[model samples]
Target: MTRNAAFKVALIGASGLLGRAIAKELAGVAGWTLVRTAHSRRDAQSVKLDIRDAAAIGDFIGRESPDAIVVAAAERRPDVCENDPALARALNVDALRFIANAARDRDAWVLSISTDYVFDGSAPPYSPDDPPSPVNAYGRSKLEGERALLESGAKACVLRLPLLYGPVLDWSESAVTSLTPAIVKSSAPLAPAAVMDAWAIRYPTFTPDVAVVIRQMLGRHARGETISGITQWSGDEPMTKFDIAQRIARVLKVDARLVAQRTPADSTPRPRDCHLDSVRLEALGIGRRTPFDSAIASVLARYPEPTQTLKSQ
Candidate 1:
């Protein structure tokens, strides 16, 4: 709470998973007035915003002139980006440059949310200092966005996150959303009996935990502190997708037969191991993270299980 010193905040993509979590966290906190905006899903309270439109973005920012702007919106699906490289560049690259430039003119610091996919998976446990080697269009576009922000000569922070799965608008909205058997339509997900990337490692971060760090970062800025440059906030536990699937079944009291299927080869080339190392974040005194398994049940409580599973006794 920056008590008695209120500041305006413009949160882009307030309707999405991580965006909604951040909105919820900042709702009643002192010294902050949230101006929510979402594309195609605007409610009565939130302003409708399409980042692709430069005039619209300029208009909104000019009207609000917020103290800080947090960009949680993105075209995140890898396959989707791969299919349409133009759309990917438009949303992930161009829109960010527009935002950064506009925010720079108004002297507002920007906090752009990024991902671990920015790195090539050949390495394990990436740090903030690691150079990005994006193999896919999605990663390439995001890496470009990072460069645009840093080069925009504006006060900006790039928080690169890892594979995210928490409460979602729809079951398929998030990659990790289908990990539970209740929502799975088949006896098992079309995965390999012996998971190919058994050695491939990753850190699955929970959204609310990320929101906590964002809030702290915002609070610090409100108190007149600087948070420039890149930071990594990942799950404490490092595990494979197979490991995650097994844990989801265990915690939800469902069958773990899904882990037995052969891993399906992805059409798009994925980084083999992009585990984000969070020692820098810890050293900087960021938020404490909940272990992946520990956070599973709580996230599960939000979404209703499928009425029935396809598998029969």
Candidate 2:
């Protein structure tokens, strides 16, 4: 089970939401050592390296000599990707290619965090074999990244997850939790109602749960298992932003003036419903779907805001 040898994992985005969660989960797990890396938000525990630089990635991997790698860094914002395709490709596609090739040289397993956006949300529940038709640059770039990693001939597994939320330094940390500040501001007297999208359906998976899943996958690999290929995990509860905001309001105990936009209204085209089938992972017994209500409540408690109402200023 490789218990006699030390297992080192290089976490490539230790400052981001999912990265932080993975770091925490792996911290307490016995027989796993973490070498964390960051780019924009460099920290003491992390070694700062530009993912866009192939040379830097190669050097870092050579020096660290980790047994496995977990990549969480990316240009995740859809709008940012939409506005700048080049930047998106550099970060999402090119950087991943660098890491994959480097890992292949070391014969190290690579688990890359991918998104459900690879599929245009047309089909109800897409399996790993389903065709990908990304609607936006973000999705397209990420899909390309998946290809780059798989094509590198590395011991790689692409774990695709849907919308994510967790404990945040700010409301804007997560698209799901970002609704909080808007809910709070709109709930104040004399403010316009917050408009939330109700057209697109999404499953907001929790990060810590995902972290646990990644750890389980790592353990499987340690015990001499084949883990390469595309795997997906997601929260089962489907809700749009409007549905999510309503739930957030309830959690905050506020009466937010929230308006529902029922039609497709995003400037960037998004899939109507991109529900990823987790049956594969379920069969392997490697996933967790935290109840959204309880999970969101935990997030709010950690980053609680001032209670607002319709009271006059």
Could you give the C-alpha RMSD of every candidate to the true structure, in order shown? 4.8, 4.5
CA shift of 79, model 2, Å: 0.7
Query: What TM-score does each of the candidates earn?
Result: 0.89, 0.95
| Model 1 regions more than 4 Å off | 1-5, 181-199, 260-264, 302-313
lDDT string, candidate 2, 10-38, tens digits = 99998888898898899887877899998
lDDT of 1 at 233: 86
What is the C-alpha local distance difference test score of candidate 1? Answer: 0.80
Instruction: Looking at model 1, report the run of 10 residues with the lowest lDDT sum.
Output: 304-313
Give the TM-score (vs. native) of candidate 2: 0.95
lDDT of 1 by residue, 1-313 (tens): 2435578789998877788788888898875899999997667768999999988998899999988999998889999999999999998989999999899888888999999999998877788998899999999999999999999998899999988877666666566665553323333567333232344566888888999999988878888776889988888687776777777666666554543323436788778779888787687687868777777777766446532122310
